[model samples]
Target: MSKRGNRLRNQGKRGSRRAAAARDGNDNGSGKRGARSGERSRIGRFVRRVIVLGVAVVLLAAIFLAFAVGFAARSIPSYYQLQASAVGQTILVRARDGSEIVELGPSFGEWLDYEEIPDTMVDAMVAVEDRRFRSHFGIDFWRTGGAILEGMTGSRERVGGTSTITQQLARNLFLSSNRTFDRKAREAVLAMALEWRFSKEQILELYLNKVYFGGGAYGIDSASRKFFSHPATDLSVAEAAIIAGLVKAPSRYSPTADVQAAVDRAQVVLRLMREQGYITAREANVDVDTVELKQQSGQNSVRYFTDWALPQLDILLPETSAPIEVWTTLDVGMQRAASAAIESNTPANAQGALVSLDRDGAVLALVGGTDYVETNFNRATAAMRQPGSSWKLFVYLAALEAGYTPDDRVVDTPVTIDGWSPRNSSGRNVGETNLRTAFAYSINTVAAQLGNEVGFGTVASMARRFGVSSPISTFPSMVLGSSEVRLIEMTEAFAAVSAGGMAVEPYGILKVETAAGENLYRHEAARETQLVPDYVAAGITDLLQAAVQTGTGRAANIGRPVAGKTGTTSSNKDGWFVGFSSGITTGVWMGRDDAAAVPGLQGGRAPAQAFAAYMRYAVKDRPVEEFDTDLDLPEWRLEPDDEALFGDPDEYYYIDEDGNLIEPGRRDPMDDSFDVEGERPGGREGNRNGSGEPPPAVSEDFLERATGGPVRAPDPPAVPPRQRPRETLDVPPAPSANRQRDGGSGQDQLIY
Candidate 1:
C-alpha cells in the first residue's frame, strides 16, 4: 500500500483492487486450515470413544473371572475335613516281655501344632522356602508377575515358581501334584481361601503338619523326633535348617540317609537365614558344627532283631490305621550284656559283633558293633566274613555223618588238593592225630583231608543244613573257613546243634497285637527237620567241647560245659568264636570293617574272650544243662605210648638240666633250663658225668676236689630229680620251686 499510495489518486482505484485480491487469498488459506483442524478434532473423538468401550469390556471380563474363581473355590474340599479324615498313626514294637522296643509310624508321622514348633524351625522354613511368607496373602503378585515375565523370556535360571507358602499348603492338602495351569489356578484360589480362613501362624502350622521329612517322618513333631530324638520345640537352629531343607526333596536330603547331603542343604538354609537376619553368621557356624542327628532305631543293636521282624507286619496286618504292638523275642538284659562284652573285649582299633540265640532259634541278644552311633552297619547279620577255623565244625560234621568216628585217625601232615596246599596254624605237623584232637586244635591239614575225603560238595551241604547260607566255595581252603558267613547264621548254626541237630531258622518276632489287646498274629513254633543225625551231632559236639576244654577255644570256657571253635583268618584280618551252651548259642566276630589286619589279634584272644564274657551273663540264673551226648562214641586216647616214642633215635626226648624227662611234644617251662641234644644210651662227651651210671649224691670232699673251692654240696634236691626211664642221670641239679605244667608253643595262645 505504501508503494501504491505514491502513485497518487490516479492509481487509487488500481491500488484498492490489488489490496482486495491479497485479502481474498489470505481468507482462503485461513478457511482451508480451519477445516483441516476441525476434521482432526472429530477423528480424535472417535478414537477416544473406541478406547473407552475397550476398557469397559476388559473390566467386565475381569469381574467375570474373579466371580468364576470365587464360585469354583466353594467346591473345594475343606482343609480341616481333609486332615480329620487323614490316616496317620504310630505302630509300636515291643520286646517279648511287652516292653516297647521301637515305634514305626505311617509313611508319614504325627502332626504338631504351630505353638509346639520351635521359632527357629519356622524362621528356617521362611528363610529357605518363602521369604515373604509373613507379609504375603496366600499369593505374591509381584513374584507371580516376575515369574510370568521370566517364563515368557525363556530365562534358564528363572523357571516359573510363584507359589507362596500358603499356596504350597493348598496344593499339598487338596490338589494333585500335577504341574498344570488348571491345578495352579485351583491352588491359587484355595490358597486365597486358606489365607482368608486362617492367620499367618495358622497357615504355617498347617504347612508344617502336612510337609514330609524323609525316613518316614511327616510333620514337624515327627520329623524333629525322627531326626533329633526330641520334640520340635527342642530343635536347634542347625537341625531346624536341616529339616526345612528337606521340603524340596525329603529322601534325597534326609539326615539318616545321607548326612553330608543333609548337612550341605542345611548350610544353604543357614546362609539364607543369615541373609534374612533370622540368625547371625557366627550362630549358624557354631550350630553347624554342634548339630547332632538322631540315630535311627535301626542303628541300635536291637535292629538285628527288628529288621528281621518289620516285614512280618505287612503280612500280619495288611492295612491298619490304629497303633499295633509287635512282641519280639529279644532279651534286653542279654542284649546289654552282649554289647558290653563286645565293647570291652574288642581292641580299640577293631570292631566286634555278637549274636546269641536260644535252642529254639529265638534271638536272645544281638550286638552289631561296639557303638552303633559310630556306624550303622549291622555286622551281626549283614556283614560276611571268613569264619576261619570255625568252618571246620561243618567239615567235621560232614565227616562224622559219613561214618567217621571222633577217634578215627587222620594225618595232620601238610597235604595238597587241586594244587592248593593247606598249612596248619601251629606251623608244625603232628604226624598223626585222631579226629577229636584235630578238631580240638583246628588243624587245617586234618580239616582239609577230611573235606577231601567227604568231598567239598558234601561239606557244603552240611554247612547249609547248619544255616551257613553264604555261598561256599568248593575249594580245599573252605574247610579252614575260607568262605564268608554272617554272625547270625553262624550262631544259628550252633543253635541247631544245641537243638539236637534240628534245622533252625533264627527269628525275633513272636507275636503282634493291637493296643486293645487284640492278637493280630502269633508265631507258632514249627518243628524243624533233622539236618544232622543225633549221633553225628553228638560226635561233633564232643569234639567242640574238647576244643573249649583243652584246645584253641579253651579261653571261651566259662567253668560250665561249653562247645565252640576258634577262627583266625589270614593276616589276622578276622577273628571269630562261635560257641553253644545247652540252652543258648552265641557267635562273636572281631575285625576291622575295612578288612585291614589288626596286629596280634587272633580268634583265641578277643573273640573267645567276648564269647565267654557274653555267655556268662546270657546263661545267668539258668540251669546248667549238659549237652545230650547220648551217642555211642569211640574212646579218645591222647597219651602217646612211651615204647613207641623211644623206639626212634631221631625222636629226641626233651630233658631238663636236672636230668628229668619231660613230655616229648610238650613245651618246657620258661624257668627250667632245658636243651634238645642228641643223647646216646650212654652220656655224651660234654656231660658232667660221662659214665652211664647215676652219680652218687654230691659230697663236700668231691665238690672241693672238683671246684678247688670250699663249697658245700648244694642242698639235696628238694625232690630228687627223676631220671629218664631208660637212661641214668649223671648229676642231680639244685632243687627248684614247684613247677606247673606249661602248655607252651604247641597250645594256642591268646594273641592280643
Candidate 2:
C-alpha cells in the first residue's frame, strides 16, 4: 500500500508538472496544452498526435507535387522553339547541261503532331531500343542496374539506358546534355513529375517527336523524309519497321551506311512484333522466305546536291527564320541518272562524282562519289582533285584577254619552271601545234608555255574572278591543272563560261514558303563580274567543242552538241571533265579514295561516259537549244590580226624559243606558227607546201572578190554555235609507277 501510494505521489507530481507546463503554454499564446493522465497514462495519445500532424503535411505536399509535375509534363514541346533557324548548306550539281535536275523525295510535312505518329513506328522503336517501354513508369530499374554493372566492368558502354520513355522525354525536353549525377537526379525528378502530369499516350507522342534519329534528322517526321523520302503518316510496314530499328543506332542501321544491317534490324523488329502480339507469329513476316520485303534505299546520297543546297537555305530562309522546307531545284530523274551513272561507271577501286547545273547555276542532280557509305569524304564537294588540263580554261581566258589568238602557235615541247618541268600526258611532244590541237589533245607542255607567257598571276586572277573558291597560286604548272579544284567549282566555272562569262552564284532553294503559304524568302542569283569577253569565251567554247568531234573528249558526245575538257593528273591520280550545253553545265571527276592512281579513270573516259549516260536520259524530251552567242565579239569573223581569217595573217609575233622571228632552219613564221587547224603538218588546207610553212590566210583581195566565192580562207560558223561532241584518246598513257600530282586538302593546293 505504501509502494502504491509512492507511485501515486510521483504520478501526482508528474501531473502537477504537466499542468504547470500547460499553464505556461497558455501564457505563451497556445490556448492550453492537454495534460497527460495522472498515473499509468497511455503513450498512444501523444504518439497519435505527432503521427496525425506528419500525415497531414505529407498529404498536402503530395497534392502540390502532383500538380507541379502534371503542369511541367503538359508543357513539353513538339519541337525546339529556337528563336531562329539554322542556315542551309550549299551543294553543286554534276550534270552535263541542265540545271533544273529533277529529284524525288517525300514532300515536307505541313504540321506534324506527335499524337499522329503511327503506333507501329512507336512499337518498332520500343522493340529495338527498350522492349519494356510501356511497363515502366518513368525509369527501368532493371536496365539501370545493367547499365551500372556494365559501366563498372570497365567497358563503359552506352548500350543500355534505364530511363523509360517518360524519363527520356523529361531529359530531352527540360534538362541539358551533361552526363552527371546531378543531371540524372534532375532527370529522375522530371520523369516522376511527367508521369504524374501526363497520360502515357501524351508522353509517348512527345517521345516520338523528340528523339533524334541521326543523319541530321530530328523528329520522326524528319527521319521519315530523309531516309525513306516519305512522311510518317504514309509509312508502310517495312518502312515503319526500318525506322523503329534505327532507334537503337540510327547511324549503324542507316541504309546509307549498310543496307544489309538496316534490313537485318528491321527483321529483328518484325520478330518483336510477333512476340508482342502486334502481329501474329506467322503473320509477322519474320520468315525471310515467306515475305517479300521491298528494301528502302537510304540514298541520302544527295551529298553533292545537299552541299549545294545547304548554302541557299540560309540565304532564302535566313538565320533569322528557317521555318519551312526549302524545295530544291534538283531534278529527281537527272539526279538519279547522275548518281547511277557514276556508281556504275566508276572503277571498282575508284570513287567518282558528277553534277549538272543550269546556266543560272541551279543544280539539277549531284553525286558526291561512288559510295558516300564507305566514306563520308564527299568527292564532289570535299575532295580536291588536280584539275589537270581542265585548268587550261583560266589560262586560255587570260591568253584571250592578253591579245593572244587561239590560232597563235605555242611550242608543245618540254618546259621547265623553277626546275619544275611540265610534260604532255602523251609523253611524245607533237612539235609545233596550234591552240585548238593543244586544247583538243590536252597538250600539257603548251599550256605550261602559254601560262608563262600570259603570267601565272593572270590565270589565278581569272579563276578567282569567276567565283571558283578553289585556291590556285601563281605557279607555271597551274596551267596544266596542277592546282586542286573540286568538281563543283570546276562545273560552276564552266557554267560561268556557258552564261556568256557572267559570274553566277549557284543556289538550291528558290523560296521558303511556310505551311500557311507565306513567302518567307525567294532566291535569285547574286552576280559577280563577267570573267571573260563574250567573243573570247565563245571562241574558247568553239575550240574546246571540236574536242568532241575529233579530239580527246569525244566519249561525252551523245547525239547532241557538247563542249567539254578532259583532265587527267600525273599518275592518273585524279580525272575530271567539266562541260556545258545550251542551258546546263556539269562537272565529273574520278579517283581512288586513298588518292592512289586508278587504271583508266581519266576525265575523258569514265567521267565523260557517265556524263553522256546521264544526259541521254536527262534531255530526251527537251528542245535542242544551242549555246548562246557572243554579242561582245563582232558577228562576222575577221582577222583583227587574227591568224586564221586573213592573208599573211599580219602575224602578232609570239616569242619563239631563240627569240627570233624565224629559226634559221625555217624561212617563214608559218613553219613554227601554231596550226589553226592541227591535222596538216606545215601545209595549206588542200595544198602541199614543201617549205614547211602553212599557206597564207584568206586573201584580202578575196574579201574584195565575191561573197559566193570560196577564194581562200574558210568562213566562220553561221548559226549560234552548237556544242560539238568531244572525243577521248584511244590509249592514254598508263599511270607511272612513281610520282603523283600535287593535291592538298579540300581547298588548299601545293604544286612544287
Best by lDDT: 1
Which segments of model 1 are wrong by more than 4 Å? 1-78, 81-89, 106-123, 130-202, 210-243, 246-264, 273-300, 632-752
- For candidate 1, lDDT tens digit of each residue in 165-219? 8898888777788999999887887887777767898788878877777766768
Clashing pairs in 1: 109-218
- Candidate 2 lDDT, tens digit per residue, 69-136? 67665674433442122222222232233343333222223245656777778776676566787777
For candidate 1, the TM-score is 0.64
